[model samples]
Target chain A: AQTVTQSQPEMSVQEAETVTLSCTYDTSESDYYLFWYKQPPSRQMILVIRQEAYKQQNATENRFSVNFQKAAKSFSLKISDSQLGDAAMYFCAYQKGATSGTYKYIFGTGTRLKVLA
Target chain B: GAGVSQSPRYKVAKRGQDVALRCDPISGHVSLFWYQQALGQGPEFLTYFQNEAQLDKSGLPSDRFFAERPEGSVSTLKIQRTQQEDSAVYLCASSRRVDQPQHFGDGTRLSIL
Candidate 1:
């Protein structure tokens, strides 16, 4: 079975500071994708960033970046210059590619981030 | 017309009541997915559909939980004789193609009483 783990149950960050949330997964598949998703109080799940396993380079989007270690099966999310608006439950997910290159994802437990003023 | 959309944003049902949750995938999307998220946990994959065919249903907790997409567009997740453990946020998502990014709907919050 494929499983993703986010060890941090809760994280606190002062506004403007940076934070890193760690994630590790157990999978035998070599070709896959990684993603970070944010769910705020509004109850909507939004994609934050994504990275393909074949690519060694990490994935980043403005304030969000990922440290994806394929060998270790680790994918950590970095939130830079965090703001109050960034407070939310952050999930790290893994997707194994299919025969046609499409894939289904498995998500980590999640890390609740609280951006304190 | 835009992002994925789910109906009955909130639902409350008794233990034996039957409930149906609807999902409208993005237009032209070829892959649709359903996930069950318990309180304070990441969403767990429940099923996957490519067009009208149900490709994967391994994530469904039990036989009581069922899902279908007859036309490969709109999908419905039905739960029979709901249990207290079934209470959770059911999420629906879709992608234009298998490798494309998935767009998600806000989801339906189902609370079992």
Candidate 2:
């Protein structure tokens, strides 16, 4: 079984500052995918970013980027220029493709992020 | 649909009652997923469907929980004899293919009283 862990339960950042949410996972499969999902107060799950294990380059989407260290089993999310809208529960997820037998995302406990004015 | 759609955003049920949550995936999507989100916790995978075939349901907490995607589009999760522990947000997501990113719906919040 694969497990994802988000050590930080809560985090806060000043407006326009940067914040990083840490995550780690335990997986024996070499072929897998990592993701960051944001759930706002609306309770809508939104995709923040993703990283393929085979890719050495980190993934970045505007203010959101990921530091994926496959060897260390670390996949942390970095949010730059944080705004009030960025306040949400962030989760790290791991998934093995169909080739690995089945598909289901294993998620971390989540880290509540607050953007202070 | 514009994205995954889950009907009956909020549902309140008495203990021992049964409840059904519906999910409509995006058109042409081949993969659908179900998750449960408890308060102050991240969403946990419950089941997965590849079109009409349910490939993985190991994440389902118990035998009382059942999910099906008969036509390869819309899916439903049924909980029998709901309990207070069953109170949580049921989220549905869909992906274009096996390797694609899964888009999610607002989720159905179930409250068992």
The lowest-lDDT stretch of 10 consecutive residues in candidate 1 chain A is: A96-105
| Cα lDDT of model 1 by residue, B27-89, tens digit | 999899999999988898899999999988888999999999999999999999999999999
TM-score of 1: 0.96
Off by over 4 Å in 1: A100-102
Q: Give per-model TM-scores.
A: 0.96, 0.98
- What tens digits encode model 1's per-residue C-alpha lDDT throughout A53-106? 899999989989999888888999999999999999988888887553436678
Task: Tell me the lDDT of model 2 at B84.
Answer: 98
Give a tens-digit lDDT track for model 2, residues A1-117. 899999999999999999999999998999999999998999888999989899999999999999998899999999999999999999899999658877788889999999999
Which stretches of candidate 2 lie above 4 Å from their native place?
none
| CAPRI tier for the interface of model 1 | medium
Candidate 2 chain B: minimum summed lDDT over ten consecutive residues — where?
A: B36-45
Model 1 sits at an interface RMSD, in angstroms, of 1.6
- Alpha-carbon shift of residue A36 in model 2 (angstroms): 0.4
Highest lDDT against the true fold, candidate: 2
